[model samples]
Target: MSTLTIIWIALPFFVGFISYLLPRFDRIFSLGVAIASTGYALWLYTQPPLKLQLLDNFGVTLLLDPLSGFFILTNGLVTAAVILYCWNSGKTAFFYMQTIILNGSVNAAFACTDFISLYVALEVISIAAFLLIAYPRTDRAIWVSLRYLFTSNVAMLFYLVGAVLVYKASHSFAFAGLRESPPEALALIFLGLLVKGGIFVSGLWLPLTHSESETPVSAMLSGAVVKAGVLPLVRCALLVPEVDPLIRGLGVGTALLGVGYAVFEKDTKRMLAFHTVSQLGFILAAPEVGGFYALTHGLVKSALFLIAGVLPSRNLKELQHQPIHTPIWIALVIASFSISGFPLLSGFGAKVLTMKSLLPWQVIGMNTAALGTAISFAKLIFLPHQKQEKQGKIQPGFWAAIALLIGGLFLANIAYYEAYSFENIIKPLATIALGWLAYFLIFRQTTVKLPRLLEQFDHLIGVMSLMLILLFWMVLA
Candidate 1:
């Protein structure tokens, strides 16, 4: 098991490095590696959970429990999808290399049990992501990537400080030791995770980065990478269940704000990016359900971003004039519905399970977000004013990704039938209906202008810092 774990972690990095040397066949080689890696991860699921100790004195370890195992598998699937999508996109060898390294780093982050290991994995992911975001080399891309690099470093500072504080008190870097640390350290840690997790204010860098990046990169950023932060937060929640309510409240706030901004967004990718934050709210409020939600969202959101990339225009009004490919449209519709909590879909199942234990206010907030999602996505169904020539053939890899995502949506409901009942499906159906109705009655003809505060990085960082202070006070008080 330890050997297998090591192989899984190191395979991508090795392949990535080798691919750089074989530039002509980089795409083919990376694709093959992705497929094999994903297959191996799935195979690992059949075996019992495993814990491997890589270092004795330094406490370096990898624990593949149910939570980490699920995330690892999901990461593998998404990485394969990303590689496939990029296979024919004419990217350079360096792009392929970075993608592979990014996948390995995320997998390592998921598998690591110690804080130091997790931090190192996260930093690798951050560096890879920064490079990927800047891969386009456009002025805007460089600016956005730089902003992400700076903000993430600041967030890491918070995490390091918190880790240091925890080590000082507990004298260990493992989660078990950190369980006894002070609330101040925990609050600092949560703040950093929230930043990386793409929570509204804390994750202010998300929208710009997700909206501006290359299609495949955007998919990975929104889908798999952001979850790296949430994984640790889930661990923290386990250590301190008392903070669940605080986390839930912050999640609700992030969700509502995300929907609010998404409702007014005109750029197709930007709207989807905001919805990422909103969906994350649901996950934070219910980590158990979050696993399924994150998995479903990662797949669906990646597909949507890819579809957006192929579109002639990203503006909703302009999109209504361009002829869209049938498979792309089908995938887009399914993904939109999945995110909006249509009954019998992945999002619906996750929402049902998440709401089962929520407070009334939280339930109301979630339903409202659902309604907002429905209203916001309604624009997608609008047909072009004039029919035009269909776009180029959709890639086989993209089609495969869509199919897998749709399958995951169905499986989320079927596999979790023990937690999902017929009664549980009712609310989401009603919510969807209400959302469409509201869209028709009100938002269809009107557009609200958002302040576009996210683009102002300085303001966002200040606000994020204030929120962290408030969180510390709330937790310590």
Candidate 2:
């Protein structure tokens, strides 16, 4: 690794230690460290990939590719935003710990090349996320976070077993070297990674934990943390495209279930969390059908979550009752549109790219996923505070986040026009219209009216089935 890459990993650790040692000066130190790290990550993205061999005989290697660079940018960008958002929230030590560790783990995941290295990186990220999500010590927070911890630890166990199997079968831990081994090892690797990636039932715990956390923490969990799974999944895609038919089926099932769950969810944050799992399903499905839409989905989804993190409410209820008519609500509206694939939004480029990249299996299955996402976010069309009240001025950090989000829009437009066609834009718009219609018919009423039967059953099934599903996917897929 180059000096810059070394700093990329080291800066966060330095800041984390400093914040821990001197908790009084956390905000200043935290913001300074986050901005520097984000700036460094962006700079690194523009440079050539640095290759390094860490373990000699194991052939351990590291390289920064465009996909990894994109996520690195996301991890840094969102970490900076969250830290800034919490600047005056008076929880400096907690925020610093979560932010610094989250950034470090994400950077590590992006840089790892060997299974052992990747596993360690992911474990760090997951644990840091668990801390962030459960930072608040309320009963609900503890219960939800414990659920996240249990599911993630189980996923880690699956990963370890797979690593041992691969080592026994391939005699090496490097992803490249392992690829040259038997296809069965590759299959096992995918199975393990899929559990981490939050496939359907395997990831049932995601929605509960993600939505129950604080806004900034939820943003980290959604924008930077969840993408950790995608990092390994994307890399593994090259090795194991045909790991398990059940994995692909689970991807589709998760996509469907996520949308279904989100469509009826009353809480704003929980709905957003469900969408994350749903969106990941789409990404997982894409690679299965031999397309790169999964990468597109991951990037766009990460950006959307970062923007959503800055919103002022945890649910439609809060946004509805709280005084809006402020710049922040407007910004949130833009984010909703962007996530919903509105015309001239970043999501539009991503959706168009995804549609173009699809094969037969993806064309139909993921099309539904897109429409479901549109419907889930459709509540946003009428969801913002309808009435006006005394509003506070937007913070500088809020503006900073908006600027970054709008910049993302410009980048998305470039991607679209470079690969653009009239037909591409038309199809996504038509699908959006279709989604609007479906939202009116199926989801409009029940979204606000909580169904006791479904909610109870989801809680029961969601909690109980996650482990079984994860193990089954690991073994069968």
Instruction: Give the candidate number with the greatest TM-score.
Output: 1
Those runs of model 1 whose alpha carbons end farther than 4 Å from true positions after fitting are 359-361, 383-397, 418-420
Candidate 1, residue 113: lDDT: 73
Backbone clash count for every predicted candidate, in the order shown: 0, 1
| lDDT tens readout by residue for model 2, 1-477 | 476666677778787888888999877877777677667656765677777775487754677766666667667666776776666667858668667877887778777878888888888877777777677878888777766666666667756766776788677787755545554455445545655666665566676677677767776777667777766675665555544344455567778878877888877777788888887776656443222233334334444455555556666657665555545556666666776777776566666665565556756787788888888777766654544465454445656655664666656456556545677767777877888898778776663554444333246345434545454455443
* Model 2 error, position 43 (Å): 3.5
Model 1 residue 473 CA deviation (Å) reads: 0.9
| Cα lDDT listed for each candidate | 0.79, 0.66
* Tens digit of per-residue lDDT, candidate 1, span 212-291: 99888998898889989888777666666777677778778888888888887888999989988888887777765567
Error of 1 at 9 (Å): 1.3
